[model samples]
Target: MTEVRSTPTQRVAPEEPPPSDPVAAAWTDYLAAARQLDGVRRGAATAAGEQARSVQAAREELTVVRARLAAQQSRLRERGVPAMALVPSPPEVTVAARSMAAGPAAVLTALRTARECADAADGVLDARGWVAVVGVWRASRPEGWPDRLRNLLVYGPLAVLGPVLQVVLVLTGSGARIALAVLLGLVLPAVAFAVGWVGVGRFFRPGPDGRLDRTPRFGVLVCGVPAALCTAGILVAVLTG
Candidate 1:
């Protein structure tokens, strides 16, 4: 029996059959993966662009911020604000401390109360074009000859006197005429600036609430122009002499 028996055959399980549309299935999977990868790539690129734009805008804004700060610093320097003025203090400020508390306190308290009352009363100023207080308070009246003469008497001499004093000071202190002339040169421009600052503030301002007839006048004509003209004449005389 052993001689006649055949070797035992090995048994193998059948493999799973491939899908009928195997190529289509593989192509579908490949396309889905490609779409997912494309979505991720687009999102990353968009985020990078948005970040770059934000950074660029911030840089541009920084330049404007720096310029404004520099201008403010320059103004403060020109005004010569004291270091002590920058020291932090309580919100309450007392103009006079004499006797530690009395009439001055009462006056200041009254003034503050009055200001608050005025502001509250005139809260509609912008809405009413500044007529909400005291029956339409107005600008400084255009002055006639007498008033003009009075102002001129007060302000005109300042233009001439300031430059004269500066020139005299230079003449007395300096040995060389050239140095004196240079100082005069510097002083005239300074006088022009001073005259313009004061004159424009006091005389050339537009009327209250920017009225129709409130166009600014040439305040410089009263002070700056005269000073400049006189300085020019003096310059010519001194240089020629």
Candidate 2:
């Protein structure tokens, strides 16, 4: 009976000190850093995009100015005034010194003095006037169908072959036609360049500062892209034929 006696034991409940954990604080800090990094990355990307757009905008502005200058020159030609007169003059002032020693009104002397003043004033006026004229001229020139088509016709092929002719010959062994293709290639782009220079001169106007008022990238693209496409077409036709 004594050997059958057993000892009774009490159980103590386990304690949890607090709900807030250090791990959670670390996680919060990590998330904050991640968010800040993301914000900085986004800001940089935005700035880069804006800068690209600004550059494109500036290019466009120059083209517009060129067009305006051309138009103004054309208009002046109609009025018998040289287009150059519309151009701004350098800002050098001319001084005419007069002496009272010439004596009492001296009708001949007065007439001479008057003429000199008039000539000086006219020169100043012409310089300023031309600047305005050129500005207007550039603004009004047209960039229409003919100009676009011409550029496409010329630059298209050259743009394509200018960079790829050698590659094609090495791969295809079409050496016989290579010279011909190259010739064709060079011609089209040369024509396009000439067209562009002339067309730009024809349409765009200048500003008061004698600068083109608008950018011509669109015009350039219009000509350039088409020429490229034309080249591709020609190449494809020749290859497949």
How many steric clashes between backbone atoms does each model show? 0, 39
Q: Lowest summed-lDDT stretch of 10 residues in model 1?
A: 211-220
Residue 155 error, candidate 2, Å = 61
lDDT string for model 2 (1-241, tens) is: 4677677998998997778888999999999999999999999999788666655654555455556556555755765987668665554211212332333333234444545654565576578789878877755444323444434443444445443653454356566665555465546555555565565555544444675422345445544564466556667766887
> What are the Cα lDDT values of the candidates?
0.53, 0.56
Task: For residues 1-241, write the lDDT of model 1, one tens digit per residue.
Answer: 3567689999999999865898888999999999999999999999788666655654555455456545544544555867555333544444333332544334444444544544453454344544544243332333322344434543566556656654665456454754554556556655654664555346643434662221123233554565566556666756777
List TM-scores for all candidates, in order.
0.30, 0.26
lDDT of 1 at 23: 88
